[model samples]
Target: MATAREEPQTTSRARGDGLYYGWVVAWTSFGVLTITYGVQFSFGVFLPSIARDLDVSRTQAAAAYSVYVLVYSIMSSVSGALTDRRGPRLVLAAGGVLFGIGYALTGAAQSTWQLIVALGLIAGLGMSAAFVPCNATVVRWFAHKRGRALSVSTSGGSFAAVVVPFLAGWLVERTSWRVLYLGCAVMLLVGLLVASRLLVGRPEDIGLTLEDELGRRGAAQPRPATADDGAGATGAGAEVSLTPRQAARTTSFWVLVSIFLCTWLVVFLPLVHLPPFAEDLGIGATVAASLVSAVGIGGLVGRTLTGGFSDRVGRTVSLAAVLGVQVVAFLVFAVSDSLWTLYPAAVGFGFGYGGTTTVFPALVADLFGRAHAGALTGLVFAGAGSAAAVGPFVAAWMYDLTGSYRAAFVLSAVVNGMGLVLVVVLRATTPAHPGGRAAEPSPLRGTGQLAPGRRR
Candidate 1:
């Protein structure tokens, strides 16, 4: 059903130039995530300012972020369904506009309610739109390289985490937080333009098929597509496909959801409150902000390394190890007061946190298959979204009541330990194929084998 204008001409150029267009998709996804999550993650930098400026309690200020996460989680499944039907370009375009407008409006808010409406509801919807489509698109584009490609694309968030907090903190010192929000709005608009131009729904929309190594080792060859063929027709040979309902029926899905929930509960605690926590310890705001940047630095390494490592070590093992590190990191943060101690703790937490972002998507695809990846991943992400919504608020309330972050940090460590236990259980319970990949053969029916010369 693609219009003539919608069909990509890049397919022909890629065939002639000997470069796969899928890499283009990967980098484009990277750019989108970098800009969106970069701005999104910078909320901690703005949190203190918002509290000081609006005369709100820490719990009230944190509520804006909580609401954002709540709305974002609710919208993710909707966006994922839309992406499955309408494609990423439209979804991303809408996201860009919504994110820009919502962010810009936050600059004008005079009260906490206005702030929540501008940032929590509107901007949250925008982020929801951008996340699943880009991730699901990348999963569909590569088979042999799915994990690496997803990692590379998601590493943008880690890269953003490293840079944005420091930059926002520095800017807040020199300028108003309002200007920062407006600047982010402009950047999102530019990202939308890029997404509209380059973000295709599937590789088949451009006349290229998925990489040959995507299917079973000895499956039959795919038939050549005729000019009249639709995108679905061309992609009929994808190795495995599944509906969201079908995937939801499996026990592994619930296990994955629980893991996501616990990890995210721990992840968002530091992300939303790390700066204030550091400031409470007598660290300067700029220096406190650097703690966030340190997390980003560690995350950058974690995301990239975990992606490629999971391919070799298997997803469950990599996940369990990462969760174990998170538990130790939280405990470190709970007991430490010195900047020297906090820095290493930040790096450790960030590294483990970054690994989850990379591993979860690849794990979902590995377990459920690529066909309905967007919807299923979105459904799974609802767990994280719920955790994101609740975690910060809980931490803020705990701090307000107890007059310290120690209890909150201790709670994070405990939950993360619980996550590690779940990962172990998941690993033991989930069935694996002969090659060690999660079994997904039911969805592979009718998807022909890789072409002879095209196998990896």
Candidate 2:
């Protein structure tokens, strides 16, 4: 195996086309997320219409959401292992196809059980493959701009949320809920086709090297986190190029995983609650539908702004900000009952949630290095996915008991607070490097500043 520390024989600078190539890779990652996570995020838009059309109870229809999350969470490991083995192209393309097929099949689903199998299981699995791999690939392609790149690409999920819900809602108004699914199927097909054309399998496949991707043309550079910086997530025998296995032995890996899981738990609970919460407040159906789109818009704004900010301020700062915003948003959510109050809550929550997606992948790469990035991120995301699976049900159970969403809202606040606490703990405990081992300080430590003799 080619060790991460061994510079690639070829560099993107040698081709003088690395910048343009990096954008291509970033766009590809965006496309992959658009179909998979985008569709997944839009599920709430179809909830009321799907339930009315199918004659299922809201609680029963909610099962589809539960199943989708369950499968998505459960399959994350498999997706990561596969991404590391096959590269992202096949994995993302397959996800696109599976998602497209799942939506198409969902249009024909005559029973709740069939919908679960089609949209929940098949589509969820597809998204799992698409999202984790695309995230890992972005880690490979951009080093300097990793935060911004990941923020931009992962923001696609929020973009889809912003767009797909409104589109689906309009389609439902114009035709039927089934047709909405058919439209999604067609869109997913197109997204998959685009991903197929654009997604290069690896950096070597695209004729680039990792260094060309370390930061932006004029951005401040942060040093890679090292094992000794209280970041021994990469264990012994590790160097500049570290892999997931190398990082697994360290305390940072689990801490990162724990922190993210807390955030995701908060993230998914609201996804399930948003549409109905608006409906319960006596908001107009169309307006409520539009609110679903607002989350996406907030996410787009959040991801774009936060990702770029992380490049300048550092990943930890951005992460902390996102968690803080989430805390405030959930606090608003717990008290709000009208559109006037809830609209702002939706925007804040979506923005914070969306930004979290953008920051997470870059943070993972910063903490662990790129050698085993795909596998490590996969494992970390798997924990987040598992949290997502349980979160909605927890919300539902709370609602079932209270006959009101207040308890659920309070619970979301608590979960977000937990994430904030972890963020504090993370900063306090993690070293800038790993293993207390000093060969040369990791280039990724502190910030990506050059040594005294090195050129700017």
What TM-score would each prediction reach against the true structure? 0.88, 0.85
Residue 231 C-alpha lDDT in model 1: 24
Please provide, for model 1 over 325-389, each residue's C-alpha lDDT reduced to its tens digit, 9 standing for 90 to 100: 88999999999898989999999998998888888887777766666788878888875656779
Per-residue lDDT over 1-456 for candidate 2, one digit per residue giving the tens place of the 0 to 100 score: 464433243343434533446667788778667666656666676777777878986666778788888787768777777777877767767777887888898888888999899988888877777777777777777655677778767877888777777776666667877877787788877777677666655565644554445423223334443422232423322335445666666566677888888888757766666777787878766677777677778888899999889777666667888888888888888888787877787888888988888888777776656656677778888877577877776676676677667777777888878888887776655333333322222323333321111000
Q: State each model's CA lDDT, in order.
A: 0.78, 0.70
Off by over 4 Å in 1: 1-16, 212-238, 431-456
TM-score of candidate 2 relative to the true fold: 0.85
Query: Evaluated with TM-score, which candidate comes out highest?
Result: 1
- Poorest 10 consecutive residues of model 2 by lDDT? 447-456
Model 1: ten consecutive residues of lowest lDDT: 447-456
